[model samples]
Target: MDAERGEGSPHGGDGRLRRRAFLVGGGLAALGLGGTALAIGPDGFRNAYARVVCGGVPDPPVARPGARRLSEVEGRTVIVSLPPRPRDRTTVVIMFPEGTENARASLDLCSADRYLAASGGRFAVAAIDDWPSADVVGTVLPHLETQGFDTGRIGLLGWAAGGAEALRLAAQLGSGRVAAVAAASPAVTAARAPLRDLVDIPVWLGCGERDDRAPQTETMLKGLRALGATTEGGISSGCQDTAYRVRVLPEQFAFFSRHL
Candidate 1:
């Protein structure tokens, strides 16, 4: 879900644009979700396609303090983290990372611990080796609900391709069940999710000016807004596509906090 700076984004830079395509196996380990195995080209398609095309902002590392657990639920593997004591009205954050390599790294990048702390232990975080999408939300959603999470307070976060995947899940599940969705430099090449279905969902897109993926994200934001989804995004000057996931994480945390 993060990356380095590049030049020539139409957002105002003059460098050539670059796009990375990923091919992942179901076993690839993702940020804090436990590692899943991957099969990719030696050229790094697994890493590149999983990240967004952009350019750089720096921030403190994203880490949470608590015990981490890996287990199986309903035939799927999941990683869960909780504050020593959780509060009532907990928000459930389900995330997908930018690449197979950063699967476990996603927990900090998405500010899972910060949410738990900010909400006074009112957030429970969970992630899986494979993102819960149209193919799996049916199973993942019900399983999470059975585990004591408020299905109505779900939030979805992803980096690069994951962001678009989050949007796809939001559309499939409907706003009645999802509260917020966030994406950073997502590698979404098409708008496959039905905008009409996101009328009441709140979505936040974070990307930098120097990042080449800004236009696509901004376009998606515009589409979501036009379709009446409550949407907002931060377009920071000099922010790189690779770096925005961490750099704008604080902003993302606040957005999810308000919506969740």
Candidate 2:
């Protein structure tokens, strides 16, 4: 749903262009039911607002075949989906679930399993359900290495709150360990200290035009670009929920493929 920013984009001559493109394309649909109509009752209002502004409540994602749950990895739940025929030094994309969603929800929301299966096994996908720490990667990487994945090349994908976590991880792990990062509707309001660690890493960020977090994401994107960090993506159609995040997944994966 997000506009691809390259040499030329509709909103502006440069990538600094903001939400006009997405709003022009999807404004009406994004304003579904209108704000007044959604303010009727608490539950009704919340659901309506979510649908119109936070992306519709998506159905639970069905698990694709070849997906495996590995609870033994550092005693934490990790869902891994490998390519049907993986290379001995296979690259891996590690996904961080948003908020309280589990690893499975992360995989389903982003459709990482399907992406891997349909994309000809270019890389493996793993999702973990931990927060605020980079230590998980230390254990997860070694485990993946034993399982035949190349731990050296790694990509990180994070949603909403997880986006900040991904940035933090990439910073803590450094570019030597983390190849790239893709953050969707990230909760980051400004370029924080962690960003200082990512100047060498390619970071792709996207958010919905209607999402409350869009402005923050835009600010972050601009700040990153100002800092000369390798960045892409801006505001997109839809909101801050699963639908919008899912819409941005393809570009994220593509970015990872090019970097990781």
TM-score of each: 0.66, 0.73
Best by TM-score: 2
For 1-260, candidate 2 gives per-residue lDDT tens digits of 23455556644444333343333324433665544433453445446556655565444334344546465565667677776666667788888768867677767665667656654546778877664443566687887788777878689888888888888788888888888899888777674636677888899988889888888788887877888999988987887677887767767877877887
Indicate which candidate wins on lDDT: 2
Q: What's the lDDT for all of these models? A: 0.62, 0.72
lDDT of 1 by residue, 25-142 (tens): 2223333211322333323434433342332234444444555656666665766666546655456777777665333566755456554554444456777765533234667667
